[model samples]
Target: MWLFLSALVLLAAARSLDWQAWLADKSRQHLCFGAAIALVPLWMLQAGIRDGLEVHFLGLTTLALMLGWRLSQLMALLSLLLVTWFGIEPWHEFGANLLLGGILPISASYFVFLLSYSYLYRHLFVYIFVAGFFNAALTMAVKTLAFAGYVTWSGQYPWQVVVDDYLSILPLLLFPEALLNGMAITLLVVFRPQWVRTFYDRDYLINK
Candidate 1:
């Protein structure tokens, strides 16, 4: 699968660069800085098919906001340009998606991170679990609405078809996605907390 290949490429690149060492170097950090800039467009292309450019832009923007104000601005510009280049949706829809994705996840991550450290660590499992659940729920909700409109206008399969065909498999899909996202976040926080931006002085509490 293309997804598997992409993962392999990222892993191979990380290994070839000795990313652990590179993470500590100021120059390499700048390279990451630029790559992060480049990532906006690439992420948009990857995410555009399922969620559209708006959602991808919003998600990246939200992540950048968690970093800081200045960085957020920079990322916002990059997101805008990337979304425009993709031409996947109207500008208004793009803006709305950006707002929804950016605000919701960042706020959720921030509040969760601000909670007790033990909870922050342990509940991250819960966080990703819930994220997966919510993502599935929201996706189903949107699809249901869309299907309803289609049936209303064209007199297609009854509403139950949507549930029977789509909702049934959601749990299976959600569990793995949640577990993977949780693991990724956990590894990043544990090994590369500095790159996370929002991980500030409070994170030091764990070691101290």
Candidate 2:
């Protein structure tokens, strides 16, 4: 399927990115991360083109802020593309669902992880739990606002349509996404914390 092909292409691209070298150079990684974060809202804008020009600035910005731009960008694109290609809905609906449901919540959770682990608390488990909760809440809130705003502005969709969209999609994606982000952040902290610039280590944990 197209989704599988996209995944293959993404994996290939990632493999070819010279990550070993990129990882060694902080400046290059920072630039790549910045560019990646900048692309998410643009991708969302493209998905929302049929609707009005309302920006769904959920925790994606937070994720970018917390995850050092590069990883956030990479994850956002990966989640968006994956959901679109493999989801049950039609392509258009899939893209919308991805932006609203999968991308937003996961990104929000990533943001929460970044903020809490870096600034507030360094305890890994507590950070993961809080991130999951915030991701779920923000994903729901953004979807509600987006649906209501679309209906108010365009007057084209029925209430049933809105309900159906959420009912059909959001429930399916929430938990798996939270788990993925949680596990990913936890592993990064444990094994490769320096690669994740959003996390700060004072005493050269990598060498020790």
Best by lDDT: 2
Off by over 4 Å in 1: 1-42, 45-77, 116-173, 176-180, 200-208
Worst 10 residues of 2 by lDDT: 46-55
TM-score, candidate 1, is 0.44
Candidate 1 clashes: the total is 0
Quote the positional error of residue 80 for candidate 2 in Å. Answer: 8.0
1-208 per-residue lDDT for model 1 (tens digits): 3234323433443455444664577864573456346556544543311232112212332243235333433344455456556774446444333333333333344444444334534433333333323433343334334434444344444556644554445455444433444454456556766655544544444354
Residue range 1-208, candidate 2, lDDT tens digits: 3345434544554665667877898875675555445545444543233343232333443344345434554566654554345442347544444444444444455555556666754544554456444454455455555655545445666666655543345554456444544555566567765545555564323343
Local distance difference test scores for all models: 0.42, 0.49
Clashing pairs in 1: none
User: What is residue 205's positional error in candidate 2, in angstroms?
Assistant: 9.5
Score residue 108 of candidate 1 by CA lDDT: 44
TM-score of each: 0.44, 0.45
Task: Identify the candidate with maximal TM-score.
Answer: 2
